[model samples]
Target chain A: MNPAYGPNPWQQTSWDARAACNFVFGGVGAGLIVFAVLFGAGGLALKGLVLAGLALVGLGLFCVWTEIGRPLRALHVFINPRSSWMTREALSATLLFPAGLAAAAAVPGFAWVAAGLALAFVYCQGRMLQAAKGIPAWREPLVVPLIVVTAVAEGGGVFFVAAPLGGGGTPPLDALLGAMLLLRVLLWFAYRRRLAGTVAPPARVALDAAGRLLQLAGTLAPLVLIALVASGAASGAAAAALMAIAGLAAALGGAYVKYALVTRAGFNQGFMLARLPVRGSR
Target chain B: MTRWAMVADLRRCVGCQTCTAACRHANATPPGVQWRRVLDMEFGEYPDVHRAFVPVGCQHCDDPPCMDVCPTTATKKRSDGIVTIDYDLCIGCAYCAVACPYQARYKTQKALFAYGEPIASEAKRHDDARLAVATKCTFCVDRVDAGIEKGLQPGVDPEATPACVNSCLANALTFGDRDDPHSNVFRLLAENQHFRMHEELGTGPGFYYVWDKAAG
Candidate 1:
């Protein structure tokens, strides 16, 4: 196999920005479902959040549909759930969409089911990345946990920002978002460490830069904002504004992390020819 | 009960790329798509430099990650050990392309030609179903199957063999059933020290490289 020279060589991550959107939007959507189920105070606020989550998920699926080379054959994506994580993700969405809609419509006995399916959808997304064995960075065991934690963190961040827009805020959500951020930061560190040790040098360099950006923008910045909110250092209106800004940073940072991993850091294990011809006598 | 395998003797390979040309002609692959390729590697310092030619393609592993990740069940391994793709069933999601460790798969979305001209031979064999579908070498399954139906052996009969193996000018390439004790590949394995790429990953590749210390 030829050595992968130069920065940003062509890789085997056939899934492009559309696939990244599918994972990001779907994860955030699912996270919103879980957030509403746990902390929503009912009325239009809860309904709006639920509807937004459903739309985001629908949009994400549409993005994947557009990414497929043969869109007319996309229903085949649901055919192999027994083996393919992509099929399982599609199957889970079939349950999630209707359940989410029912929850948004204030139907009884649907919120819990929607929340459960949302979590399942997030899990399926992680598994899909893990199953891509050719990409050494994604195939790491840490990827599953990293993706799950980041999804929840992004979801919490979205809720924090969007909830304030409706003139509603929850104290528990602030604490929850803080905890998710902490976990996400820790997992990001561990995942990057493992990747740094194992991936090719070129990929490691890319991952290292991505990791530093995520640490500062995705982890530390939100952490400081969350601390200010928790310390009661700001007035009520000021705190809401700070929380919303923090939420945006966290959400954008999480999306950047996913985008970098999926696009920039993703690299296939290049071909390997084990033996070298002996020196001289050519 | 057959386990098809290929062996390339490093000492005999000349890096002439005849096998690459033959494979391209046999498959009628579009430009920039090579189902079989010879990789040239240079080793040692300038004064003592030597080059080794490595022929690479799909190993058709016992545990094929591509097969496992296919959302539409489009990739499957035959009982005889050849991995095949069902292009009709493939949605061209390219999941299998990234999942393959060997980088064996290719997806050609548009028709491309060599030398900026659509060659008559390529146009004649153009397959629309192949567009956007993942494709790779099949070890010449069509020839193997046809020859088997006619009671001919694969490694011994030119008509039944893979184009790459048949086209090897220096006799570096060999194809046979690894499970057969008397097969040429089995004999080569017994006489030469052999290695498979990424064996640590536990893919159990059907392709092998035979090396002799004396050749160096």
Candidate 2:
């Protein structure tokens, strides 16, 4: 009963900005590998994008590594696959790195293998938050789809931004970006509505700002840009530049929302008193 | 086949915090951490108000979320139903901290002292292994184990009972085996109307709050 942290649901201090960075980086990274394979990039462009995806995931894992209290015992994170989503994530990473390298090397049939592992990695990341029953904002069943869909949208955004830089020129990623972004926006609103009663008041306030940004820049503006590109308002470098801008908008939207979700909205389930005890003859 | 549990009679509690002091004195929990603390709550509006003191801590649930989310398997539930932590095996991920609905888990990276500096009492209990790992109430597991080894019953023996229960000035708190039909906890539950916190969450909490039997 610390007077400061008391009886109501309080924001959890267990995770900070670093934990948010993991999802931001890892989500885009995992999404990139899948999109690259699905879109069919070859030669140096394939290698470049795949390597970039693997690097981002590695960076995300490194961020978590720095936050551990006992870094020496980190290998123990792989010990509990029977129950822990985190252990499944680590195991997926072990497979993802090797498969990503082979795909980047243009090995036949490896791209699909790498993409599958990457998708599983992203899935594990989503489950990580859902597993925390104490945080009402996270334990919502909708969080899984929301996170997974956002990553795919962000990945499609990164694919458009990076694929054309090496002249590997994307094949109509604008439609894919629009599709994922729309889905994400819908899921975001649905998730917010679902958490209306469960989350603390402060958490709801934090989610509101992120929700606005996601709806505007992540979904609406990107759809407008895709239309302009299709109507041939600009072509060549100008068109490529517009697509990259749209992609960055989508990617950053998901990341900022995730950051807000982890840092600002992570509230612990406070004490709940169902009824007061009756006094004698009162 | 014993499931250790505790019950708090809300009518009898006075919000004195004597149990809190005893728990800290027994466990030497670092500053800002209370393994056992009573919640002082007020209900109703002006001209008609009532205050209630509800003791809160680790519920030690039958299905612990902390245990399921732990990647290291460092948190485990014993046969006696007390959840324990393996400090050395824990990587200090704080995953369990977020998983606990009762907010019972505590994790700190640095060794803390009660005074500005380490005093004689603080220096004697400087534990390095506990740092950077989750720690919480074990329902005084060590005392219960030792007492049991000496052929002493936990509910009946003052030495085996939790420090908080032993120090309760109002005699509001009781601890005993839940499965034992002849135990104090079983008798109390049979005689009184009680409720567990957040029962809707399906935590199956070991702690119970006794209100009244007449109302039921």
Candidate 3:
């Protein structure tokens, strides 16, 4: 990891950095598990992804306030917690992560239990974004299902590269990934069709950006994952190297999708633009 | 059942900004930030353009989203309909600012006090330091409180009927106990069926605007 990516030196080690780390990991981690469980082969590698997701959620609770004096004050959110999903997200993540982690890190005998916990965490994460009334894009009806599908697709891409037929897990896993990827394509159509109705320009832009990235990942990444997984099954060292490269691409592509959603696609320009009238339009 | 309210007659409101000036004086609000803003609304176009002065301020809604969304119990609805903010408890998050569809809340900008004492010296002071929390019309809470202490009606005072209502040369603005049927506001409400801003949102704002037949 680059030093630039590390925690800033000026702040307290346990405060801002912890919060930022929690947000980044919790967001990325749960997202990964959701993708994995939905798309990836059910096995030891899927278990690892689930554990990492839970860890991120646990860390998110530990570091709730990124730039506030009192972290304990976050408890007040529960007062109107019925209306405020931020509070619910906090509490759900607190429980979900630990349970999911235990399940993921468990022996091969209890691996199925861990996958179940990961599944629960993903649903809660979807609901959390749904609760934020301020962001129109996040609050959309399509967002929840799309989030789940995206998570599974990304997870499958990772699992495909890692798992070999018969040796790693069940043969049905590959078919499941292919099905999930196909479902993702269906979701892509659904999201775009819905976007056509949204009058909010910024929201439209953000959805388009997210939709484009997912389309790229769905089209190219899965083929690479399958190729690498198949090659590794036939050859040995060279195939493993190819599999590693394919995994990296999937991971990078996943990051790109997230980046598009969280940063560039989050164009709240409509809010400001609403304050102005079109001057040039005749 | 303390329904503190205001009634503004748009017919008499000349858009002269007298009420705006009076509010600015009473609140001693910093430059640019007005507790009450007079919005100039233009209808039709060209030769048919007719302007109406819409005085915008905190409506003190029955179901305020600001109070609902506030993370801390900083903003509360008084027993009276006045929505008051606890400055000490406010974390300055500005969530209420956005939640308010009216855009009633204004954050104190650095430009509000760029010249420090020199600019402030020219302006009347109301203990509003440079970077204070959100400010809005209090329905003259201080006056209403003082009047109640003096054993008078809750909202009426000889010296203070809210600076805007008092200073209105056209006598367009009205303030009284909305619960009292005999009150001028209640009678006006009965007669005119005044318009409430953004009535569709179900906020049930206390402020009512009586649009005159000629004005409309």
Top TM-score prediction, candidate number: 2
Q: Candidate 2 on B75-114: residue-level lDDT in tens?
A: 9999888999999899999999998898888887898877
What does candidate 2 score on TM?
0.96
lDDT string for model 3 (B43-125, tens) is: 55698655556666888888886676665666789977889877655544454653564567765633354256536444445
Please write out the lDDT profile of model 2 over residues A11-110, one tens digit for every residue.
9999888788888889999999888888877778879889999999999989988888898899999999999999999999999999999999999999
| Candidate 1 CAPRI level | medium
lDDT of 3 at A76: 52
Fill in the DockQ of model 2. 0.66
lDDT (Cα, tens digit) per residue for candidate 3, span A27-117:
5566556655544435566566676666655665555453333333455545445543344455555556555666566545334444554
Name the regions of candidate 3 deviating beyond 4 angstroms.
A1-27, A33-78, A94-282, B16-25, B28-32, B108-114, B117-137, B158-161, B169-172, B212-216
User: TM-scores of all models?
Assistant: 0.94, 0.96, 0.65
Query: Least lDDT summed over 10 consecutive residues: which range in candidate 2 chain A?
Result: A1-10
lDDT, candidates in the order shown: 0.83, 0.87, 0.57
- Report candidate 2's fraction of native contacts: 0.83
User: Which residue pairs clash within candidate 1?
Assistant: none
State the displacement of the C-alpha of residue B57, model 1, in Å, after optimal TM-score superposition: 0.9
Choose the strongest candidate by DockQ.
2
